[model samples]
Target chain A: MKKINLLFVLTLGLIFSLSNATFKTQGYQVGDTAIDFSLKNIDGKMVSLQDFAQAKGFVIIFTCNHCPYAIANEDRIIALNKKYAAKGFPVIAINPNDPVAYPDDSYDNMKKRAQEKGFNFPYLLDDTQDIAKTYGATKTPHVYLLDKNRVVKYIGAIDDSPKDAKKAKTSHLANAIDALLAGKTIAVSTTAAIGCGIKWKK
Target chain B: MKKTFFLALLLGLLAQGAHSQTIQTIKIKDLVSHLQKNDDTLRVVNLWATWCAPCVKELPYFEQAHQHFKNQKVKIILTAIEDELPKVQAFAQKRKLQSTLLFLDEDNANDWIPQIEKNWQGEIPVTLFVKQGKREFHSGDFTAEELMTQIEQRLNVSKE
Candidate 1:
């Protein structure tokens, strides 16, 4: 019985270690201020997070070319950028996935995708993935919204749909952006992001 | 001789194409039918995609657990929701994914995603451990050891 007890204690310790192996991701709250970082855009131009923050607010989307969820929302993102850019709220899209594992999400493909899709905003690459790590971006299409003060206003899914746009019941990203633009508090500050998980380098 | 060799190569290519295994695309209907069989058989289903980095990283763990529990009445399925069928089939073949491979071809995932679990936020690498009516949905990656432990615990506690 003593031997069995020792074995159980050892097993419990092993389980705790295994479960904690994954890096702990940070969650963005409503009042948290977002830090700025420079990253290369699809056109090979250096774009800084502060460049967009000069305006009323910014839409920082953690996205990649490969994920179907990101691909599906391409149009919506473009539309949001075009619609809100004039209002001093432009989208600062970032590709956070490691390029080595996913060649499709590399800088070259990002440029191709941006040009092909006619993205109005700067589609940047988080080359070192530091920006993604800082923001704790875990999904391909995770979103982060900031107000004029550079405080994180929202962090969550683009919408409630991956395939069918008609069936989407919630527009978390949109609602947050609209509320910020209209000078109103966002109703939903955070929601669990859904999409292809970000591939991080070992 | 060159012409004959070229002809042989062409024939080989055609044969290979003909013998290619079809990626069984699972719809909601098929999933329901699969669940109906051996209602007592606990099912641990993982929804993933070939392009998803975390999903690809953690898939071998699930496969290992599936092999470990093969003797038991439990069933494990790994569904890849790649828009391109050929890519998924090629990936499965390359990885030799042993966990009853499935391709979810539905363009509208919201319809079926909720059907599997309402709490699911449409995240890949999400795991569903279900036995009879009891269900535990986890939305993240797990190591081989962690997954095995989870399988053992869930299976033991499964009432039905």
Candidate 2:
């Protein structure tokens, strides 16, 4: 049965090809140097991590408008800037979602959201997602706390609670910032919290 | 004509009343216990949420795999954490998801994220394929063809 043999071979070949799925590398781990970028902010001006000359460090947040988790943290992000910007660890937010996939996160909508939220920090757009990729961002509401040297001192969720901000008992970002400000080692270098996966380009 | 119209309307309403999707909220301990040791069956647990776009996008792939590998010993279960019953149920019903669906009640993500996977950062759309107490974890979206391949690979590994 030559025909049967050929059919079997073809099926095997298909299985082999499928089994070889391509694996892409993930983003940076803790203790890694975070990459800097110049992405457009809601103000229509390009913003870079190096632009904040006076800051001792930064609270880089990879967030988007479409994600409910990000929406929940918007006010808290503003608060972080209000409290820390004056003390030098300003919040620098970047949206990494592809607007074509999530039209609500488009530049125009970003401008509107920033104004509506009264964002005290720079809400930049990661149009190419290069900065996000370099920093190893996997989802929205992801946070990376870095020193003035751009060294990522901490990474993960803002706090333990995502549903209700009031229920948050431990402020992870605040603790890390405080440690850096006090010139003490961060108590918790990394932590995980459930978040919306970044909407990557199709 | 009026009687026929009324009769048809009644039947439509009755048919609409019958819904099939089931959403359950269970403790993490129960979930861990459910991952029973099975040498022949491949259990695929997909962690997702209503707010996660990638998880929603990759659902069809799991569904297609379930249908295509009907004769194979494979089970696909979807677990959504953080989404309450109303939201999780609505999304499952709207998508007509055939795979088993669940909602995780344990909130303190810091406590559970590490328990599930030491390396996982609590991101949604994470899939775990388990066979014979061995697990293969994949984070992010997977195409249908790629999923099928991964299934076959896991199956083959377990056999050896």
Candidate 3:
């Protein structure tokens, strides 16, 4: 009788835990052709994915004004844009979090952040969050690197560190860009990106 | 009459205790020991700020996960990374965060962020899944479903 009761309890426990199981969507995959989406930049001008397809490659990063990770990397991203833009590559920043939930990440604040940071790239806001959803971006500072053919070469982190740069173990994003620029295939195509999760519209 | 007065006083004390079951604010230094002692159980620690919109949006998912595993032995601690104590407290009050909510008391980001996750870039809404020293740090907002899957997967691995 006790054995039967134990089995019943264990079954009940398993059922309870499994009922709440949820999974993140697997959207874009490596080697998949990148999709095109139009989003308004901080200056209110609409930018599309196709705008940069003519380049040798492009760095697409989902970032916002309030996330410390994104804020800390603003300088690095800007530098990447300047260095790579002249070399047929550009960095595109997208704000995917809900602006209402975060007033600091609103369009006005994005513009302020861009101006204050002297961002050379187009800092766009995904108002409907469609772009972010399509990309399966779960956090601020999520990155996607695409080659000239618009195939995803890398889909993960900006770098290995969000806190102390001196101690980072890997420069995943930069290394990927370097490999692509030098006509070498990237080794680490995906990584578990760490940062502020996206604030989806409630 | 003396007995009645004592009974009334006892009831008042109980009421106070019930109404003031506020989450005790423990320093990060103290939290490590508590976590260590609670081994054999999964701990999902989220670093967020009440001011962070993405953090706020994903707060409910964490709360749901906590409730789902309440009877089990999992601990879901939502630690606010807000430096402003008053604001953190007020936000907690306003949002009615029911999980074990804590405010990271550390102010030196350069010193502390690395301690939490070497790759952490001082971002809010960062979550850590730890079980028996096996840890996974995900920097992004998650839906309730995604959070639960990760928790379940971690717990399964821990059990194994």
The TM-score of candidate 2's chain A against the true chain A comes to 0.88
Q: Encode model 3's per-residue lDDT on B11-106: one tens digit a residue.
A: 997665443114556666755544455467888888877556667788889878977999887898877664467877776666666677776665
TM-score per candidate, chains pooled: 0.66, 0.83, 0.61
Chain B vs. true chain B: TM-score for each candidate?
A: 0.77, 0.82, 0.78
* Candidate 2 Cα deviation (angstroms), residue A140: 0.6
- Write candidate 2's Cα lDDT for B1-160 as tens digits: 9999999999997665445348778988867755655576898988888777777788889888877777888988888887787888887777777777888999888887876677777767788887877666676778788789878877687568
**Better TM-score candidate (2, 3):** 2
DockQ of each: 0.23, 0.48, 0.15
DockQ of 1: 0.23
Give the docking tier of candidate 2: acceptable
Of candidate 3 chain A, the 10-residue stretch with the lowest lDDT total is A17-26
- Could you give the fnat of all candidates in order? 0.36, 0.71, 0.20
lDDT of 1 by residue, B14-105 (tens): 66545423467877778655544545677887888776777888888887887799998677888777457788888877776667777876
Error of 1 at B78 (Å): 4.0
Q: Return the TM-scores of chain A for each candidate in numbered order.
A: 0.86, 0.88, 0.85
Best by TM-score: 2
